[model samples]
Target: MKKIYNNLTFRVLTAILLGILLGHFAPSTAAQMKPLGDVFINMIKMVIAPIIFLTIVLGISNMGDLKKVGRVGGKALLYFEIITTIALVIGLVVANLIRPGDGVVTTGLATSGSAEAVSRYAQQSAEMDWMDFFMHVVPSNAVGAFAEGDILQVLVFSVLFGMGLTRMGSSGQSLIRAFDRLSKVFFNILNIVMKLAPIGAFGGMAYTIGTYGLAALLPLGKLMITVYVTMFLFIFVVLNLVLRYYKISLWQLLKYIKEELLIVLGTSSSESVLPLIMDKLEHLGCSRSVVGLVIPAGYSFNLDGTTIYLSMAVVFLAQVFQVDLTLAQELTILGILMVTSKGAAGVTGSGFIVLASTLTAVKVIPLEGLALLLGVDRFMSEARAITNTIGNTVATVWLARNENELDMKRLRQVFNKEEIDPLANYDY
Candidate 1:
C-alpha cells in the first residue's frame, strides 16, 4: 500500500480523478487551479532547451563518424514522411466513411468565445509562409533561439555545433566531457521537476473541465468519437504492424512507458514529458545518438497525431457546411496538410492554426465552420498528444534497431523487471 501511494503513476491517476470531480462540482474554483498546471509545464520547459542542446551536441561529438550521422538522419526523415503521410491518408479515409459532421445544424451557432479563438489562429495562419518556415529554422542568433525556446532552431544550431566539434579531433575531448556533465545536471533537474507532475496533471484536468464543461462534448460528440476511433486504429493497426515486424510487442512498450502516457493524458501536452521519454528510451537500450537526434526532430517532423487531426478536422468542417469536395480537392487537402502540419511544431494553438491555414488554402470550406470545433478541441488534444508520444517512441526504437545500436539483451532484462538499472551510470 505504501509503495502504491508512492508510485508516480498511481499519484497522477488519482490526481486526474480528483481533478475531474472538482471540475464537475465547483467549476469556478477548479478554473482558478490553472496556475498549478502552468507552473509545472514551465518547470519542464526550463530544462528542455539545455537538455536538447547538450544531448544533441554530445551525441554527435561522440558518434565519431559523420557519414553514419547523415545516414541515420536521412533514414529517420524518410520514415517520418512515409509514416505521417499514411496517417494523413488514414484520417482522410476514416472521415469520409463516417462523415461525422454531416446533418449538423450550423445556423446562429454560439460563436461568442469561439470566434475570438478562431480569429487568433486565423491571423497566425495568414502570416505563415512556406519560405519563411524554412528560413526560421536557421536561427540568425543562437542565443535568441535558446531564449525563445524554439526546438527546430536549437536543433539546427546544435547539429552545426556538434559537427564543428567532431572536426576538432583530440582537441575537443575536454569540451565533450564538459557537455556530458552538463547533460547529467539537466537530467537531474528534470528528475526534480517531475515530482510535481501530479500537481500539474490535476491542474490541467481541472482547468480543462472547468473552462469547458463536459456538456461541450455533447454537440460535437460524433466528431470527437470519430477522431478517437481513428487514432486508436492508427496505433493498434498501423503502428502495431510496424513494431511486430521488428519483434517488439506494442503492449510491452506501452506498459514500460505507461507513466509518461498518463502524464501526457492529464497535461495534454507531449512536450511536458519529453525529457522523461528520452531518458526512458535511452534506458531501454536505444543509442544516445539516435535518441538525441530522432526525438527532437520527431517532435517537429513526425507529428502523426496532429496530421491525422488536421486532415479529419478539415473534412468534418466541410461536411457540416454541406460543402461537397471532389476527389482532386481532397487530394489537394492531403498535399496541403503534409506541409501545414509540419508548421504546427513550436507554435501555440498550432493545431487550429494549421487547420485554419489549410481551410483558407482549400477555399472550399467556410472558415466560419471552425467556430464549431473550438469548444471541443481541448478534449481532443489529449488524444492527439498521446498518439504523437507513442508514434515518436516507436520511431526512435525502430531506427535504433536499424542502425544496430539497440541492445536486445538489456531490453529483454528491463522488460522482465530485473534489477538491472539502465540509469545507474547517470545517477538520476
Candidate 2:
C-alpha cells in the first residue's frame, strides 16, 4: 500500500518537473505534447455518458418509485443551486476586491488577438438562442445523442427512461435489478479506464508545458497564484470549518481519497473519477441512493471552481480592456452566473462559454478574453477540476450525514484509523 502511494506521488511529481523543464527548454517539443492531452481527454470522454446513464438508471430503478427519485432529485438540485450561488457571490466579492486583472496590458502575454476573436465567437454563439438551447436538450434521436456524447441530453433521456422503468413497478424492478448488475460491470470498465490516468497526467502536463512553456506562465503568474490561493482557502479553510462543525476531520477524509484526487488533478476531468467517487462515498457510508443522485447533479450544477473562474476571469478581462464596471453591474454578473452556469453540466470548455455569457451580460470585458486565457486554460482547468471535485465530495458526505444516510462512526473509523494496510481489504 505504501509502495502504491509512493509510486503515485512519484508519477505526479515527475510529470510536473518534466513538464516544467520541457516547457522551459524545448517549447516546440512541448507543443507536440498537445496530442497527449487530447488522448487523455478522449479517454475520459469515452466513458462519461455510459457511466452517467448506468448510475442514474441503477439508482432510480433501485428506489422502485419514480416519485421518490423526483423528490430526492428536487432536493439535491435545490442544494446545488443554493451552494453554487454562494460560490458565485464569493468569487465576485473576491475578484472585485483583488482586481487580479487590473493594470494588466501586455500584447505579449498570450493571445492578444482575443479582442477580434471574442467578437467573432459571440456572433456565432448568439446564433444559438434560447430555443436552440432548449431544443438541443430534447435530442432528435437518443442513440445519436449517445453517439455524439452529449451528457445533459443523455441525462435527460436517462431520467425519463428510469422514470418509465419505475412506473412499470414489479416488471421494471426486474430490469432495474439487471441495471444494478450492469452498474457493477460499468464500474469495472471505469477501473480499467482509470489505469490510464498516469499516462493521461503525463500527457496533460507535457502538453501544457510545451504549449505555454513556464515563461509564458510568468506573465499572468499573479492571477494564477491568486486563483490557486483562493481555491486552497475555500477547500481547506472554508470547507474545513464546515467539516469541523460536523465533528469530522477534513484532512482525514482527504487522505482517504488521495488517490482519487490525484487522478482528478491529472485528468482535469471530474468525470474520470465519477465511478470511483460513487464507490468511495459508499465505502464512507453514504447511502447509494443519495450518492448516486447528488454527485452527478453536482457535476452539472454545483461547479464551485468553474463559477469562481468565470467570475474572476471576467473581472480580469475588464481590467485588461480598461473597462470600469459599476457595483450594480458586477452584482448582475453574479446573478446571471448563478443561472447560466447551471444548465451546462459535465461539459469541458463550458467555463469559457460561461465567461463569454458573463462578459456579454456586463458588456465590459470582450469575449476575446477567453481566447487570451485559452492557452493556459487547460493548466488552470486541472486546478478547477480538483477544487470542484473536493467541494462536491465534501458536500456529498456532509449532506449524507444530515440526511441520516451516513454512518458517523464509520466515517471516523475510516478517517481516523491510522494503520492503513495497502493490502487491507477495500470493499470495492
Candidate 3:
C-alpha cells in the first residue's frame, strides 16, 4: 500500500480522476486552477534548455567524430520525414473513408468566442514566413536563444559548440567532463521538478473540463470518436509495424514510459515531459549523441500527431461546410499541409493555425468552419501529444540501433526490469 501511494503513476491517475470530479461539480472554482498547471510547466521548462545544451555538447565532444554526428542527424531527419509523410497520408485516407463531418448541420452556428480564436490563429499563420523561420533557427545572440527558450536556436548553438570543442583535442576533455557533470546536475533538478507532476496533472485536467465542460463533446461526438479511432489505428498499426521491423515492441516501449505518457495525457503538452523522455531514452541504452540530437530535432520536424490532426481537421472542416474537394484539390491540400505542417513547429496554437493556413491556401473550405472545432480541439490534443511522444521515442531507439549506438545487453535488462538501478550505467 505504501509503495502504491508512492508510485508516480498512481498519484497521476488519482489526480486525473479527482480533477474530473471537481470540474464536474465545481467548475467555477476549478477554472481558477490554471495557475497550478502553468507553474508546474514553468518549473519543467526552467531546466530544459540547459539540459539540451549540456547533453548535446557532452555527447558530441565525447564522440570526437563529427562525421558520425552528421550521419546520425541525417538518418534521423530522413526517418522523421518518411514516417510523418506516411502519417499525413493515413489521416487523409481515414478522414475520406469515414466522412466524420457528413450530415453535420452548420446553419446558424454561433461563433461567439470561437471567431476570435480563429482570427488569432489565422493572423499568426499569415505572418509565418518560411524564409524568416529558417533564419530564426540561427540565433542572433546565443544568450537570447536560451533566454527565449527556443529549442531550434539552442540546438544550432549546441551543435556548433560541440564541433568546435571536438577540434580542440585533449584540451576539450576537461570541458567535456565538466559539461557531463553539469548535465547530471540538470537531471537532478528534473527529478525535483517532476515531484510536482501530480498537481500539474490535476490542474490541467480540472481547467480543461471546467472551461470546456463535458457537454461540449456531445455535439461533436462523431468527429471526436473518429479522430481518436484514427490515432489509435496509426499507433498500433503504423507505428507498431515500424518498431517491429527493428525487433522492438511498441507495447513494451509504451509500458516503459507509462509515467511520461500519463503526464502528457494530463497536461496536453508534450513539452512538459520532454526532459524526462530524453533521460529515459538514454537509460534505455541509446547513446547520448543520438538521444540528444534526435529528440530535440524530432520535437520540431517529426510531429506525427500534429500532421495527422492537421490533415484530418482540414478534410473534416471541408465536409462540415458542404464543400466538395476534387481529387486534385485534395492532393493539393495534402501537399500544402506537408509544408505548412513543418512551419508550425515552434508556434503556439500551431494545430489550429496550421489548419487555418491550409484552408486559406486551398481556397475551397470556409475558414469559419474552424470555429466549429475550437470547442473540441483541447480534447483531441491529448491524442496528438501522446502520438508525437511515442513516435519520437521509437525514432530515437531505432536510429540508435541502426548506428550501432545502442547497448543490447542494457536494453534487454532495462525493458525486462532486471536492472537493479537503470541510471547506474550512466555513472549516476
lDDT of 3 by residue, 1-428 (tens): 99999999999999989888998899998899889888999999899899999888988987789999999999988999899999999999999999998987776443467778878888987888678788888999999999988898999999999999999999778888888888889999999999999999999999999988898887778888988888899999988898888788889899999999999988999999999999999888898999999999999999998889888889998888888889999899889888888877777888888888888889888888988888888889999999999999989988988888888777877789893564465421
Residue by residue across 200-290, what tens digits does model 2's lDDT show? 7666677677766666666677788878877787788777876787788889888888877876776577776766787888777676767
Q: Relative to the true structure, how large is the alpha-carbon lDDT of every model? A: 0.90, 0.73, 0.88
Looking at candidate 1, the ten consecutive residues that score lowest on lDDT are 419-428
| TM-score of model 1 (CA atoms) | 0.97
Against the true structure, candidate 2 reaches a TM-score of 0.88
- How many residue pairs clash (N, CA or C atoms closer than 3 angstroms) in each of the candidate models, in the order given? 0, 3, 0
TM-scores for all predictions: 0.97, 0.88, 0.97
Name the regions of candidate 1 deviating beyond 4 angstroms.
Answer: 108-111, 421-428
- 391-412 in candidate 1: lDDT tens per residue? 9999998999888888877777
Error of 3 at 346 (Å): 0.9
Residue 331 C-alpha lDDT in model 1: 99
